[model samples]
Target chain A: MTAKITVEPSQKRQQAKQLREQQLLILAQQILQQDGFAGLTMDRLTALSSVSKGTIYNHFCSKEDLFTALSVDSLQRQLQLFQRALQIPGHSREQVLALHLAYHRFSMTEPTLFLCLLTATTPAVVEKSSPARLALRQQLELQLAAICQQLITAAIAEGSLQLAAGQSVDALAFVQWAQAFGANALLKPTQQLGLFSQLQPQPTMLLGVNLLLDGLNWKPLSSDWDYHASWQRIMTILATEAPGADGQLN
Target chain B: MTAKITVEPSQKRQQAKQLREQQLLILAQQILQQDGFAGLTMDRLTALSSVSKGTIYNHFCSKEDLFTALSVDSLQRQLQLFQRALQIPGHSREQVLALHLAYHRFSMTEPTLFLCLLTATTPAVVEKSSPARLALRQQLELQLAAICQQLITAAIAEGSLQLAAGQSVDALAFVQWAQAFGANALLKPTQQLGLFSQLQPQPTMLLGVNLLLDGLNWKPLSSDWDYHASWQRIMTILATEAPGADGQLN
Candidate 1:
C-alpha cells in the first residue's frame, strides 16, 4: 500500500512537470507572435510563465534551446499536416501540391512560428542547440521527406512523371521541397521590396510546381490541361485557407 | 577665384564623406564575418571604425539600418556578379544555369554576407530600416530581376523555351529565382540537419534547375544533351570556384 502511494506521487509530479513545460511553450509562442524574435528574452519568459529561472533552465537549457524546442514543436505540427495531406484524394502531382499547400497554410497561420523555424537554421542557433533537440529536428525532417518520397514514387508509377537520366526520386523530392521553401520564404520580402506585384502565393507556388512538372514531362501537361483549376481543387480538398482569386482566404 | 575655392571645399567634403562611408561599411563587414549578427552593435562599430556614435548614426540610422546597408552592399555585389555571369557565352538556358552557378559561388565564398542579406528580410530588421535604404534595396532587387528577365526573354525568343498558357515571363523568372534561393538557403541547413548525406549544393542545384527547365520542356532536353557537361563548361566560362567532380572548389 505504501509503495503504491509513493508511486502515485511520482506519477503526479511527472504529469505536473509536463503540464508546466507545455504551458511555457504556449506562452513563448504567444510572445513570439506578439513581438518578433527580439522580444523573446529569458527574463520575459520567466516573468510570463511565473516559473523561476532555475525551473525554466531545467525545462530548457538556454533561450536558443527553448526556441529550438519550439521549432521542433512546429516541425511536429508540419509532420502531422503533411500526413493529413496524404489522405486528401488526388493525383500524385496534385498530392504533392497539396503538401505544398499544407506548408503554405501553416506559414500563413503561424508566421512567427515559421520564422522561428527559419531562425533555428542559423549557425548561431544550430551551434547552441542541444544535441538531442537537433537530432529530433532531423528525425522530424526525415519523416516529412518520406511522405514526399511516397508521392513522387506514386507519380512515377502512375506514368504521370518520369525521372531524368541521372535524377533520383530523392533528388527530385529535395528540389520540390527547396522550391516550395524558397517561394514561401521569399514571398513577403520580395513583395515588400516591390519586386513581384500581385503575387498570389498559392497560384504562384502551383505555377512553379506546374512548370517544374511540365519540365519533367509529367503528363496532363499544363498545355493539355488546366493545372490552375487543379490548384483550386487541391486547396479545397486540403481544406486550406489559401487565398483565392480575390486573395481572400475562404 | 573665391567662388572656385568654395566649390572645391564642397567637392572635397563630398569625396571625404563617401570615403568615410565606404570605410565604415568595410569594417562592418569584417565585424559581421568574425562574429554573427548578435556581435554587431553600435558600440562595436564605433570601436572598430574609430568613428563616433554620432557619425555612425549619420551613416546608418540604427543597428538594423546598418545591417540593411550591409544587405544593400551584398545585393550590389550580386548584381555585379550576375552581370558578369551574363557575359559567359552559352545558350540562353546555359546562361541561366551560369547565373545560378554565379550565385552558388557567391553563397559558398561569402556565406556570412549571404546570411546578412537573409537577415535583412526579417521583420525586425525590415521594420526598423529607413525608407531610403528600403527603396535602394528594392531598386537593386529589380535590377537583379531584370537581368534574369533578360535571360528568360532570350530563351523564349530563341525557341529554346516556352511559356505555359497564361504564364508570364515575370512569373517564370520569379519561379526560377525562388528555386535558386530555396536550394541555396536550404543547402546548409539540410546538410546540418543530416537529412541528406549526399546533398552536393552544386549538383543538387543544377539538378533542380535542370528538372525545372526540363519540366518547361526547354529544348535540348536532358535526355538529348548532357547538361552536366554544360554545367562544368559554365564553371569554366564564368571562372567560378564551383566544386570539381570531387566536390572541391577550384
Candidate 2:
C-alpha cells in the first residue's frame, strides 16, 4: 500500500510533465504560425507562454532544440495519421495509397508545421539541437520509414508486388517517400503558378502515386481497380475516424 | 557614322554591365558557399566585389533579388544540360532518362547552387525579390517544363508511350519534375543519415527515376532494357559533353 502510494504520485508527476510539454509545443506552434521562423525566438516564446523561462529552457535547450521538438511532434502526428490510414480494409496497395493521402492531407492542413520536417533536417537546426533531441528525431524518421517498409514487405509476401532483379523493399519504400514529398512540396506552388493550367482538375497527388504504384507493377493497377473510388473511400474513413486530427495539434 | 558610333558605345556599356553582374554573382555564390545563407549580405557582397555599391544596387534591388538572379542562372544552366542531354542518340525514353541523369549530376556537383532553386521560392525571398526577377524565374520554370513535355509528346507520337484516360503530357511532365526535385532534395541527406544503409551500392536516384518512368509505361521499360547500362552511358556522355558545367556557374 505504501509503495502504491509512492508510485502513484510519481506517475502523476510524470503525466503532469508531459502535459506541460505538450502545452508548450502548442504555444510554440501558434507563434510559428503567426510569425515565421525568424520570429520564433526563445524570448518571444517565453513572453507568450504562461510558463517560466527556466521551465521552458528545461523543455528545450535552444531555439533549434525547440524546432526539433516541434518536428518531433509533427512527425508523431504523421505517424498517428499513417496508423489510422492503415486501418482501412484493403490490399497493401490501397493502404500505401492511403498513406499518401494522409500525408497530403496533413501537409495541406498544417502547412507551417509540415515545413518543420525540412527545417529540422537543415544543418543550421541540426547543429544547434541537443544530441538527445536529434536522436529522437532520427528514431521517429526510422519509425516512419519502417511503416512504409512494412507495407512493401506485406505486398511482396502476398505476391501482389514483385521486386525486380535489383530492387529491395528499402529502396522502393524510399522511392515512395520521395515521390510523396516531391508531389506535396510542389502541389501548392504548382496550383498558384498555374503551371499545369491545361491539366484536368483531378488531384495530382493521386495521379502521381497511382503512376508510381503502377510502375511497381503492384496488383489491382489503376486500370484494374477504381482507385478514384478507393481514394474517396479512404478519405471518408479517415475523416470519420480522426475528425479534426489537425485541430488536435493545436 | 553617328549611328554606328552611338550604337557601339551603348553596346560596350551593356557588355560591361553584364560582365560586372556576372562577377558579383560569382562572389555572392562564394560567400554563400563559405558562410551559408546567413552570412550573405549586401555589405559583405560589396566588401568582396570590386564593383561599387551603386552598381551592385543597379543590378539587384535586394539580397533576395540576388538569390533569385542566382536561381535564374541555375535554371538556365539546367536548361543547357537538358538540351545537351537530348543531343544523345537515343529514343525518347533514353532521352528522358538522360534528363534525370543530368539533373542528378547537377545536384551532386553544385549542391549549394542547386539549393538556390528552393531558397528563391520561399515567401520571404519571393516577397523581397524584384518583380522582374520573379517573372524571369517563372519563365525559366516553364521552359524547363516545356522540355519534359516535348519528350513525353515525342514518346507518344512514336507510340512508345501511352496516356491513361485522364493522363496528359502536362501532368506527366510535372510528375517527372516533382520526382526529380524530390529525389534530389533527399539524396545527400539520405546518404549522410545512412537511411538506406542496407540497400545496394547502386544510385538510388536512378532506381527512383526508373520506377517513375516505368509507372508511366514509357517504352523500353526497365524489364525490357538494361537501363543501368544506359544510365552509365548517359553519365559518360554528359561528363564529356560538359566537362565543367558546374564550374561554369562558379
Candidate 3:
C-alpha cells in the first residue's frame, strides 16, 4: 500500500484565509501610502481593492484591526531587510551596522509606510484593535527582536563586542533598536525643521551606532577601525538586495 | 539720565497674544491628557475655557495649529528640564546623563504630552499647521538642541569626551540627542509589549549613554568607574530640582 502525507481540512482553510488576508494587505498598504490613516476607511479599501467589504471584514474585524495588520506587514518587510543585511559577509558588529543601514533605507524608501507603522501604534489604534491582532503584532515584534538578539550573542561569542558588568544581551539589543529608530524617525523631521541642518541621517546614525558600540567596548572600536568604509560596504550590500537603493540615500 | 524701555504697539500686541496662547495651551493639554487627541476640539475648548471661538482662532489658525503650539510648549518645558539638569553639580558626563534622566522622567511623568509631540511631527499635522506656527515650533526645537549642544561642548572641552577623526561638535550633539530620544521613546512600549520585560528604562538608557560615551572614550567609562553610582548621584541631584522625583523611578 502507498501512503501519502495530506493537509487537514482546517489547515487548508486557514491557509486560504491567510492568502486572502495577504492580498487585502497589499492593497491596504497602497491606500495607506496614498491617503494615510484617516483615509483608510473600510469603504475606501473595499472600493479600491475590489475585495468585497464582507471578505475584508472576514480578514479584519475593524479598520483599526486592518491598521494593525498593516503594521505587522510593515514590520515583516523591515525584518526581511534586516535578514538581508545579515547575509552581507562581515563580523557581527558589521552585521548590526548593516541592520541599522537597512532600517534607514527602509525608512527613506517608503516614509509613508513608516508613518503607517507609527500611526498603528497610537493609543487610538491600539485601544480599538482586536486582542488577537495585537497579539500577532507583538509576536512579529518579538521575531524582529530575536534577529537582533542573535547578532548581539554572536558579537559576544566572537569577541567583537563585550557586555559591561551587569549588562545583558537583551538590554543591548533594545538599545540598538531604539537608537536606530530614533535616528531614522527623528532625524528626517529635525532636518526638515531646519534645526539640525548639518545633521545628515545616514552619517549621524552611523556615528551614533559607532559611539554606542564603542561604549560597549566592542572590539576594534570605530576609533581603531573605519566604520565609514564599513558603511560604504553595507550600502553596496544593501544595493544588491534592492536595486537603485544608492539613489535613495542622501 | 535713566532711559525708559518702552513697549511698542506691535510688541504689546505680541505680548498679549503670547499670554492668550499660553492660557489656551494649558486647557488644550488638559483635554489632550484626559480625553486624547480626538476629543480635543475647538468646540470643547470654547466650552471648557470660555474663550470665544474668534479669540481662539485669532491665536491659532486651526486646531492643528493649536496642537503645534502645544508641541512648542512641551519642548519648552523639556528645555527647562535640561537647563535644570545642567545645573546639577557634576562633571560634564554626569551633566549629560542628568539630561538623559530628565528626559526619562519627563516622558514617564506625562506620557500624553510626549505622545502629543510625536503626533505633532506627523505629515498630516505638519501639512495643515500655519507657516508662522511651524517656524515657531522649529525655533523651539532649535532652542532645545542648543541646550544639548552646550552639554556636548562642555564634555569635549573638559576632556570628558574625545571626538574621533572627522566628527564635529554638531554631529556628536545630534548623536546624543538621537540616542537619548531613541532610548526613552522606544522603551515604554517595548516593555508594554512584553518583549523586553527585564529592561528598565533608566538603567537601559544609562547603559546606552555609557556605551556611546565610551565610544567617544569619555573618561571614567563604565568599566573604569561605577557609573551606576554616578547614576544614583545624578538622581539625587535631580530630586532637589523637583521634589518627589525619587518616588517616580523604578
Candidate 4:
C-alpha cells in the first residue's frame, strides 16, 4: 500500500508533464502556421503560453529543439496516416499507391508541418537539435521506410512483383520514396509558377507513380488495368475516414 | 557619326555597370560559400567589396533579390550543362539519362547554388524578389524544361516511346524533373543519415532514371540492353568534357 502511494504520485507527475508538452507543441505549431520559421522564437512561445518560462525551457532547450520536436510530431502523424492507408482493402500495389496518396494528403493538409520535415533535415537544424529528439526523428523515419519495405516484401512474396537480379528491396523502396518525395515537393511550387497551366488535365503525381510501378513490371500494369479507377476509389475511402481533411483531391 | 559618338559613352557606362554587377555577384557567392545564407547581408557585402553601399544596393534591391539573381546565374550554368550533355553521341534515351547525370553533377558540385534555386522558389523569397529577376528565373526554367521535352518528343517521333492517351509531353517532362529533383535533394541528407549503408552496392540515382525510362517503354530498355554500361559511357564522356567537376560519381 505504501509503494502504490509512492508510485501513483510519480505516475501522475509524468502524465502531467506529457500533457504540458503536448500543449506546447500545439502552440508551437500555431506560431509556425501564423509566422513561419523566422517568427517561431523561444520568447514568443514563452510569452504566448500560460506556462512559466522555466517549464517551457524544460520541455525544449532551444528553438531548434522545438523544431525537431515539431518534426517528430508531424512524422508521427504521417505514420498514423500510413497505417490507416494500409488498412484499406486492396492488392499490395494499390496499398503502395494508397501510401503515396496518404503522403500527398499529408503534404496538402499540413503544409507547414511538411515544411518542418524538410527544414529539420537541413544541417543547421540537425546540428542544433537535441540528440534525443534527433534519434526519435530518425526512428520515426525508419518506421515509415519499414512500412513501405513491408508492402514491397509482401508483393514479392505473393508473386505480384519481381525484382531484377541486381535490385534489392531497400533500393527499390528508396526509389519509390524518392519519386513520391519529388512529386509532392515539386507539386505546389511548380503549380504556383503556372508551369502546368499549359499541360493537359491529367494528374501528374498519379502518372509518375504509375510509370514507376509499371517499370517494376508489377502486376496490373497501367496498360493492363485502370489504375485511375483504383486511385479514385482509394480517395473516396480515405475521405470517408477523415472527412473534410482534404477536399482538394482532384 | 554624331549619333555614334553620342552613343559610345553611354554604351561604355552600361558595360562598366555590368562589370561591377558581375563582380558583386562573385563576391556574394564567396560569402554564401564561406558563411551560408544567414551570414549573407548587404552590410557584409558592402564591407567586403570595393564598391560603396549605394552602388551595391543599385545592383540588388534586397537580399532576396540578390538570392534571385544568384539562382538565375545557377540556372544559366545548368542550361549550358544540358546543352553539353545533348552533344554526346547516343540514342535520345541515352541523351535523356545524360541530362539526369548532368543535373546530378551540378547538384553535387554546387550544392549551395542548387539550394539557392530551391529557396528562390519559396513564397517569401519570390514575394521580395524584383519582378525582372523572377521573370528571368522562370524563363530559364522553361528553357530547361524545353530541353527535356524535346528529348521526349524525339523519342516518341522516332517510335522509341509512346505516351498513354492522357499523358502529355509537358506532364512527362514535369514527372522526370520531379524524380531528378527529389533524388538529388534527398541524396545528401539521407546519405548523411546512413540510410543506404545497409543496402547493396548500387547507383541509386541511375536506378531511378532507368526505372522511369523503362516505365515509358523507351527503346533499349534496361531488360534488353545494359543501361549500366550506357551510364558509364555517358559519365566518361561527360568527365572528359568537365574534368574534375565531379570526382565522386559512382
User: What ranges in model 4 sit over 4 Å off?
Assistant: A1-18, A34-47, A51-58, A198-202, A244-250, B1-14, B35-44, B52-55, B122-124, B198-202, B244-250
TM-score of 1: 0.87
| Fraction of true A-B contacts recovered by candidate 3 | 0.63
Clashes, model 1:
5
Q: Candidate 2's residue-wise lDDT over B161-190, tens digit each?
A: 988777878888888888898888776666
**What is candidate 2's CAPRI-style docking category based on DockQ?**
acceptable
lDDT per residue for candidate 3 within B163-241, as digits (tens), equals 6677888888787777877777777667888889987777888888887877887776667777788888888776676
Give residue B138's error in model 3 in angstroms.
Answer: 0.8
lDDT of 1 by residue, B105-208 (tens): 78888888788787787766787889999999999999999998888898889899887666778888889999988888888778867777686677788888
lDDT, candidate 3, A58-168, per-residue tens: 888888788778888788888788887888997777888899989988889878777767767666567678899888889989999999998888888887876766689
lDDT, candidates in the order shown: 0.81, 0.83, 0.79, 0.83
- What TM-score goes with each of the models? 0.87, 0.88, 0.87, 0.88
Interface RMSD score of each model = 1.9, 2.4, 1.9, 2.4
User: Candidate 3 clashing pairs?
Assistant: A215-B211, A215-B215
Candidate 1 TM-score on chain B: 0.89
CAPRI rating of model 3: medium
Q: What is the lDDT of residue B202 in candidate 2?
A: 38
* Candidate 1 local Cα displacement, residue B108, angstroms: 1.0
Candidate 2, chain A: TM-score? 0.88
Stretches of candidate 3 off by over 4 Å are A1-20, A35-43, A51-62, A244-250, B1-17, B36-42, B52-58, B244-250
